[model samples]
Target: MYSPRFIHCLVSITASIVAGTFLQSTTINSEGSFTNARQSQAQKVQVLSVEFPQQQVPIVRFPRDVYPEIKFSEITQPQIQVQANKHLTIITIPTSLLFECGKHHIAEKAEKALNQVSQAINNRYSGSWLQILGHTDSKGSSKDNLQLSEQRAVAVQQWLSKQHHLNVSMVTTQGYGETQPIVSNTRFDCFERAIARQKNRRIEIVIQKLDHQV
Candidate 1:
């Protein structure tokens, strides 16, 4: 018994009401989600801001007297016999220092003296040269005495070269057996001539061609 126009009008009104209700509900839900998200971000920021104090490090100190120490071994000096002149210095090694009874080998006790002599020669006469002369007594045969004297001189030269590290070219050696005796040969009843001749047996070290400017 209802009319067609009225039925259509009622259906249109019902659809409008349902659409408005759905739109309102969607808007409320979106607003609530946005508010909840903003609150959670604010709480996270507060938790990151905590009260923490800075701790200072202490400075360490050392003793004022502390210093680097240096240590060295003590070096004992050798005894030096220096005879310096206006031109040159003559370093003499006694026969007893270089040899025994008619012997040619150098004594171990004389090493210090030889080293001292070599050092003196090296330091004092840098421009000069050394001459080593060997002397002997007249008791033995001329040939044998001459050979012995030569051997003695060579022994001295070897010591200088080996122990003192001296240049062989800077030194020259010669032997004058009984021929260049310092004391004259005399026959006396008191053995004075023998004693004097014994003194003649020796080695003479002479520095020559010195640089006078030194």
Candidate 2:
């Protein structure tokens, strides 16, 4: 039979071994967690240290040349196409937009466009001659259409002169009546024919800028 003292000593030794194993396991777990945390922090630092290149995109613009100054040429916007050829700048305005359909009177909304063009011309191009030519669709009699076209052109000329402070002598007016057909109006569809007719009715402003000789 084992002595009581001997059994007590064996039990104490087993308890010590269990405690030591538990402490060793806890220390290993703590060190593993600390290493993982350090690795995570280092990865963040590495990511932040990397550099990226920045790029700048260029903006390009293409506009028909009217005047040398960009501010002055802005009046020749997309709606009013400006074409330059041999000392002349041709600015076109849709007569349908300027005037009501089948009428000689100018539309109220046309004031905005006229104001822009007038200001540009007045401020930039001094002593330049402006010629306004009115065109019409094939609808009415030649005489009546000619008279109507002339009246429409005259109305625009007067508006530019009086409202925009342009010189009356600097502007001249002409009418083409139904003689100049920009687009053919012989479409079977009503909508298509109307579209073609609208194209025919246009107001062309020709600006002649003479050379400056010192």
Candidate 3:
């Protein structure tokens, strides 16, 4: 026996309480979903970071004229040849100019040529890679020739670093012996063979252009 107005009041109160409870539950669920989405995005970013790492140093080549300080005419000589391209600048010196027969010591006649080479490296080719490749004629045994060639290359490298105060780390030496010859070492004609042998015995100075400049 509740009055009509009282019953109506109770129903309205219950409805309001139910509506408030439902709204609060909806709000908590929405917050949880938003948090989950943010965590998922962060996890994705972490995965991407682990997938790709930093890179190493890159090797780069340059066109000729990159270092215009090296003069081709001044470095070139009667027995020495200078060749340049995008990859390397090769300076070929006859073995007779740098060394005596069966010896690795730098001769007195080689001072002028060596001075020019040192100047070029100091002037424009600083911090660049240098390779001194030694070659010989086909007169000695393969093992002996190889050792001699390596010795010659090392001698030149030492002279450059010691005399000119060039960076030693930037220089490397290798010996090809008689394996790479510019002319044929023939035995048929004595005079022709001697000429060919002279051409074959040489040292090649290779300078490579680098991306990193000091």
Candidate 4:
């Protein structure tokens, strides 16, 4: 029933309203996308800022004054004796006093006894050499055990060097491993005999008097 001119005017108004709504929606969508992009960039920057380099822990060495005491009853089964020669003073160190199972480094508890022994030697002899010997029970392979023994000896030597400020040349390390057995190798006696054989796994301090020829 409306005239042509009126209908044309109504259509124009409706089209303008729709175009305005669409423009508004497009503006809001663009703003939202920009905000999301900024947030993502911020998150990435924050992650990068928090990244840092990893640090390595240094090895710890104990002083010789803290060596633990070993009871005479512990080593009394066969009475392992330490021999002292003019150039060498062999000090028997029990496994019970020196190390725990599968550990090559010297414990902090054994430092005191080692210090005492070193002091005694220093008092009696001058310009002496110390050889740390590492021995193992005859249970594992010779090559593997020998390597472990050598590591143990080197660990003791490092401890002594750090504690006494001794020259590296004055100290030597050796690992005999299971090659030298002080007791018979048997299944029943293996553990007990290994404990007893701790005497052989000791540090021998060789005192070579400067006046004496090598």
Candidate 5:
């Protein structure tokens, strides 16, 4: 039989060991929970706080000095010819740049340029009316030239209206064959005349600002 003092001492020692073990377990669990919470918070920050680059969402504009904006699209001699007026911006796209000689079909390379134009229109000129004008030189017969010019204008209009899903009603087209000659196709030499004809064959994209903003 154990003495009373000895039994009391054993009870105290057992109680103390149990208390220490419980305390140590509680501390370990608390530390683990804190670490897990920190990891979860960091993961949430990484997932939700994603930042996009400038190129992904860049701002595009049609800058006007209160004038019409005419942007030239070319690869080799790329240029922007902006005439700042209150009413119209005439963007002159050379036929030579858009098509092969004597053909109205827009070339594969011209698609990229047209896409850029479409994107710009979507960004800034959603409310404005766009008039595309096709012109030709005096090299062909008047009837043939008229048909060709109209076809070219219609092609561009189709791409803008259908391919880009732009406002078709806001877009219009007209063809002037050898009637409005900014440069004469009448040259004494055949080579000079060809060059003049190339110049005369051009498409003008006119951006018209309406009196009331839509």
Candidate 6:
């Protein structure tokens, strides 16, 4: 038969072994959880770092050229075309609207459109350089067309100076006779040819900034 004291001691030893095993298991699990938490924190930091970059991109811009403004509403002429760019502004008027056929004189009926042009120059672009370019269609001999174009340009310059009292020194004139046609004049139909020729006959007022010498 076993002694009571020996059995009590054996029971105490078994209890101690079980308690040791449970403590060891708890310690290992706690360490694993702490490691996992640290790993998750590192992953969050990495994701944030990727989403926001450290360096920033730079923006670039070009400088605008100084130029004068033209009010389009002030020009009531339907046939006039006003075009502007970074460096120059061009006002194109059909010669047929300004003068009679084969004539270099400005018609009295065309005073309204000319008045608007003069007003624009006097208002905003008086200090700018003005170039009056005259063009003719393929109607007459090249020599005659060239002379007519020059005369027309000169007449416009004179009218602007004498009538409007603008500075004549700022204005210059040129003629391109049947050479710089805006449309093709080789159409087989007479009406189409006439239309093309009419479109080709025009006077262009080119306005440039003071920095550019005409």
Best by lDDT: 6
* Candidate 3 structure, TM-score to reference: 0.63
The 10-residue segment with the lowest total lDDT in model 1: 59-68
The residue ranges of model 2 lying beyond 4 angstroms of the native Cα positions read 1-73, 212-214
Clashes of each: 0, 0, 0, 8, 6, 0
Cα lDDT tens digits for candidate 2, 125-182: 6777777878788887878877888998898899998897788787788787876665
TM-score of each: 0.56, 0.61, 0.63, 0.53, 0.59, 0.64
- Which portions of model 1 show Cα errors greater than 4 Å? 1-85, 212-214
The parts of candidate 4 lying over 4 Å away from their true place are 1-81, 187-203, 209-214
> What's the lDDT for candidate 2?
0.65
Clash pairs, model 6 backbone: none
C-alpha lDDT of residue 193 in model 5: 78
Residue 22 in candidate 2, Cα distance off native in Å: 99
Among these predictions, the greatest TM-score belongs to 6
- Residue 54 displacement in candidate 6 (angstroms): 63
Write candidate 5's Cα lDDT for 25-94 as tens digits.
1112222344576754443222323334332211112235444544433322363244434445556677
lDDT score of model 5?
A: 0.62
**Model 4: lDDT of residue 103:** 78
Error of 6 at 70 (Å): 8.6
The per-model lDDT (C-alpha) reads 0.58, 0.65, 0.69, 0.52, 0.62, 0.70
Which sequence of candidate numbers ranks them by lDDT, best first?
6, 3, 2, 5, 1, 4
Pairs with backbone N, CA or C atoms under 3 Å apart (clashes), candidate 2: none
Which residues of candidate 3, in runs, are more than 4 Å off? 1-71, 211-214
TM-score ranking from best to worst? 6, 3, 2, 5, 1, 4
Q: Report RMSD for candidate 5.
A: 32.2
